[model samples]
Target: MSATVSREGNASVAGVNGPVLGDADFRFLREFVLQHCGIALSEQKRQLVQGRLLRRLRALNMKDFGSYCDLLRRDPDGEMGDLASAISTNVTSFFRESHHYDLLEKTLIPQWLAHKRRQGDRLRIWSAGCSTGEEPYALAMVLAEALEKHGAPFDAKILATDLSPQALQGAREGVYSLDKMDGISAERRRRWFLRGEGSYEGLACIHPRLRELVTIQPLNLLHDWPMAGLFDAIFCRNVVIYFDKPTKERLFSRYAKQLEPEGYLFLGHSESMHGLSDDFDLVGRTVYRKRAS
Candidate 1:
């Protein structure tokens, strides 16, 4: 994959006119991010664009921003996602929104079970842009408890995706600092994690059992999703804060189509589908369900 991304190109910014970043430079990065990740950035965050992309400038040894932008255009295999991952914010932890998980256990899971018992359906969950695997692990904990009740096995899956390969790897490994586990309940912490042992002191690792229920993969949301069946619930969470208006519209529509009728969609509390789509109806809080058929 790295071989195809033009890593060894002859494009150099040495002695070249560099981007000084006035209105024009800011405009270039803003448009570039929108084109690449479907994220619409605020002009107020222009300082953010400068701070984030400056690393890219240094990494490529480019004399200025224009040369870096030119290099991005030439990377045939679409490594721009790597850059997007670098700039995008990632702030999530185990059960960050405990109320949502409470809803998942007390409300959503039971409803899904009732539907499954009636329709003979298998559960499907997608954690779009799952940062470091907590949502999926939390889902697994819910599913594991759900499975324990029936006294029989059921096939299920959690698809955890992110643009950052590093994040995906972290999600896959399922290890974390003890500090990140602050708000989780004692019972959940006990059940889901293996406390640090020996040389691995101070850090915790997700029990190997819970880790098996989820699959972590690299995904670029701006492109077509290579999936077939609809999902029973999608925990999109705070992932949409970076997306532009057009991207948000189309992406929600796609999620609407890919979700089972009556299936749920969870968004960041700050993210509202208000002007975006009516395909989903608000349930309690930030949770949403697809409008009945």
Candidate 2:
């Protein structure tokens, strides 16, 4: 038999049964999430949302989805971040997209270092939506290796930003299980990570030098960005696919403005900027270079 609500309005589907996330609740959450974080949710995602937020409902002792929505309206800070965290997909690994690193090492870094050497300048890279730190840390490793190979003392730093505080906390910790090192070479792993021992055996933490090269910050791309300087390259992979077309257009435009004239922008393998913005030209697979004007 289908679960029925008690007179007290306590959730009928609590525990193993799961909360009943109705159409109204799904609509409310969809609109709220899109308005706040620009993450558009389709009707098909109703089940997905219900599954992701069931724990939140149980955590708050909410009797119904309406109560959760009311809580959101009354105290957004109390639940919004958690909601974002629950909804965010943080699947990443060290050097998940090896080709991007190859481009950074073979072409982008070398050319930019040559120009910067002439100007006596430092390099800046932004890893927008850098969930759990892998992307930025990979960039750091590649940059460090390239600098060492070139025998140059060029200053460089990476700004890694994400909307989820939970993910940022993991990024800041810079620790991961040993199995997550599959993509990293033994030499690279030895150079960039410290093997954890004792109770922390089977884990690894990024070395001090690599950690120092990346700064993790909590940022919502839909909100105001306080960064002042332009970037030499911006890696915003796998991020905008969740946003609507208009949101994507505005963000791509903003990235163009924030990038140097010759700067590069990298997107996920499944994402493209073909109709989003004309300020950048497609130069490589899932990569764009800002037009020289």
Record all residue pairs in model 2 with backbone atoms less than 3 Å apart, i.e. clashing. none
Which 10 residues in a row give candidate 2 its minimum summed lDDT?
6-15
Q: Over the full model, what C-alpha lDDT does candidate 2 score relative to the true structure?
A: 0.87
lDDT values, one for every candidate: 0.78, 0.87
Candidate 1 lDDT tens digits, 62-171: 65655666777688236565577667888888777778888988877777777687777788899999977888888888888887786666767888988887678889
lDDT of 1 at 9: 40
Error of 1 at 113 (Å): 2.5
Pairs that clash in candidate 1: 18-64, 38-244, 39-243, 39-244, 40-243, 40-244
**Global fold similarity of model 2 (TM-score):** 0.92
Candidate 2, backbone clash total: 0
Model 2 error, position 284 (Å): 0.4
**lDDT for position 102 in model 2:** 95
Local accuracy of candidate 2 as per-residue lDDT tens digits, 139-255:
999988888887967789999998887889989999999888999999998899998889778899998988878999988898899999999999999999899999999999999
